[model samples]
Each structure stands twice: as C-alpha cells, then as structure tokens.
Target: MAELDKECLFCKIIQGTVPSYTVFENDDVKAFLDLSQVNPGHTLMVPKKHIINLLDYTPEDARRYLQYLPAIANAIKEFDTNITGMNITTNNGASANQVVMHSHVHFIPRFEGDGLKLATRNNAEKYTSADYEKIATKIKEQF
Candidate 1:
C-alpha cells in the first residue's frame, strides 16, 4: 500500500466514488469488467493502493495482486465457457501502451475466432546469442 492519487481513475473507482462493474474485490485488490471489452469478458484488476505503473509496486503489493490474478482469470473463463484462452498483460510505461498511470493488469479472455490482436513483433531470429547475453547482463546488473 502507498499514497493515494486522488486524481487517478482507479483510486476513484476504489473509493466507490466512480461507478464500475466490479467482478472481484478483497481487502487490497479490486477487479471489474473493462469498459472496452476486448473480448466477451475483458477485465481489469488493480491494487486498491495508488501505486503508479508496475515499477512502482512494492514486493508485497505485487505479491498480493498477483495471487488473485489467476483466480480472476479463471472466474472469467468459467463465466464464459467460450473463453478458450487469455492474454494477461500489464503495461509498465507510456511507451508500452500504459494509458493510465495507475498500476493495473488486463485480463483479456480469448475465444475461438475472437480476433483480438496484441502487438507482438517476432524479432527473435534477428538477435544473436551475444546480443541476448549483452541485454541479459545489463538487466542482471540492476539486481
């Protein structure tokens, strides 16, 4: 848990000031149907706290929210048996398509022929083992 961003849409939703079609809620997590239904049962789950973006979450905050993600996804799947698969995603920053500053996870339920396209560029073959190691080492340095 952290400070509250009063102007943030999710914070307002959590406070019960802004109406949302809630699907799941506990002490610290709240999930609801996404306004933009990417699929039959598109949902968005967010921490009740006002942390901004994935990088802002404390380890405990991340743990609490992640523990419920599967349950929410499974519930959505069960609600719509047509849900054959799902795309669980969290965009970190604006460059990664994070329109809202608040940290949230999108649970996009997929059905047969649900023509939803996620931006997935296949550039695996373009990078060599050396290139991979270089990126990995750079990332590992932070730890």
Candidate 2:
C-alpha cells in the first residue's frame, strides 16, 4: 500500500484535519454527508485507505469497502421520510467525471419530484447474432 497523501481532501477528512458530518465509521470505511447534496440525504462512503479508484482496489479492499453500502443506504433512507429512491454510483477516471482522485461511493437519496435524471442516448448500432457472439467471445477470452 502507498503512504497516505497528506494533501488529499478525503485523507484530510479521515485524519480530522477537515471537518465532516460523519454518519458512520469503522476500521475500514467511513460515511459522511456530501457537501453537494443532490438530494435531502446524499452521503459519501469512502475506504479508510487511500485508493485512487475502483481499478486500484485489491479484492480485500473491495470487499471491505462494499460490505457496508447496503446498511448505509438503508440508514440514509430511514433518516428522511421524503426519500423515495436512491442512486449509488462511483466514477472511476476523469473521463467518467471523477472529480476527486480518491475512490468513493455516492449514496444519493431520490424523491419523485427531484429534477435529477440520468441521461443516456441510444446511439448503439444494430448487430447480428454472429456479431454479438464475436463480441462475447472476445470478452470471454480475456477472462
């Protein structure tokens, strides 16, 4: 493992150099209210260790980080009666809009009237069965 980045914002929060409204914390993970609340109960969960992104996680790191997500999400939901749904997401690289270098999972509480929407375009081209098989075969080969 690498040494903790003293300048990292998440690291600062974990070290108590910066203040945070921490909702949960354990030896391996921490959950806190997001500064930019997309909804009433938006929270951010992060590994206690400094990992750049999802691709950097070891299997143990991945397991420790993810195991608490369900309980944390449920706690957020129970905290507010207005929450109707939730969106949990983690962006990897800058191309995927990851602003922070440290990997973190976002727990966004959703309400029916909330303006937030995930936009997607159906720009995919049609493929033949053979093309699908070829694509699957290529991916399977890597595994």
Candidate 3:
C-alpha cells in the first residue's frame, strides 16, 4: 500500500474511518457524494494514495490517479438523468480554495438553473498574441 497520511481527511475516508456516501471505489480510486450537493449527483473522486495536490504528482502518480476519471464521471452522469451537463474540476492550492490538502476532483452535475455558478471573469482581452506566445513558450519549455 502507498504510504497514507493518517492526518489527512481523504486518507481516513478512503480507509473507511470517516463515513461517506461512496458511489464508486476500487484499488486506486474512490468516488463519493460531496456533502454539499451543489447539484444532484454531485460527487468527488479522489486517489486512494495520500497525494497532496496536482503540483506534487509524479508522472506515474498522475497516470494512476487520472485513469479513473472517465468511468467515474460517466457513473455520476448515469446516476442522474436530469443532469444537463457536468463540471469536472480540481483546485491545486490554497489560493484556489482547496481547503483539503489531499487532491480531489469534483464532479458537479448541472441542471438548468440549478443555482450553481461557475464563471471566470473575462481577462483574455488584456493579453496580446505576442503576450500569449511568450507565456506559452515559457510554460512549454518546462516539458
């Protein structure tokens, strides 16, 4: 087994200590209902391993963690036919509202006017094509 952070909330949930409405689970991942159901079928999928965030993921860790996304998302959608769309998202750091240090993906099922709002303020117009290329080049160099 991967080393578990016993202090981590996700680790306790995965280890069957903290009760959760588990929707799906396997050797590598577990999916369950989010306590605050922003919309019906709202769920969270997390790696069984005690990973902190995306920034800390090794390539192998990322591969094993992400391999379950498709099936988990499909399961959430299939669980509720009224779901008009879905948002699969994760926060990587404290500034991004990641209260839980352990990495998790939120599967938010959308219904028409379900009172959930997920919009980013438009800031694209501030950057020119040259600025975009410069930014892309800087980031792409890391690969």
Q: lDDT of each structure?
A: 0.88, 0.89, 0.90
Q: What is the C-alpha lDDT profile of model 1 across 1-143, one tens digit per residue?
A: 35668899898898888999999998888998889998878899988888788898779887877789879989999997678999999999999989989999999999888677786788999999999999999999999
lDDT-best of 1 and 2: 2
The predictions' CA RMSDs to the true structure, in order, are: 1.5, 1.9, 1.2
- The CA lDDT at 114 in model 3 is 84
Q: Which stretches of candidate 2 lie over 4 Å from their true place?
A: 1-3, 124-126
Q: What is the lDDT for 129 in model 1?
A: 98
- Candidate order by lDDT, decreasing, is 3, 2, 1
Residue-level lDDT tens digits of model 3 in 23-82: 999998899999998888889988988889888989998899899889888888887788
Among the numbered candidates, top lDDT falls to 3
TM-score (all chains, Cα) for each model: 0.93, 0.91, 0.94
Q: After superposition, which runs of candidate 1 have C-alpha atoms over 4 Å from their true positions?
A: none
Candidate 1 positional error at 69, Å: 0.8
lDDT of 1 at 137: 100
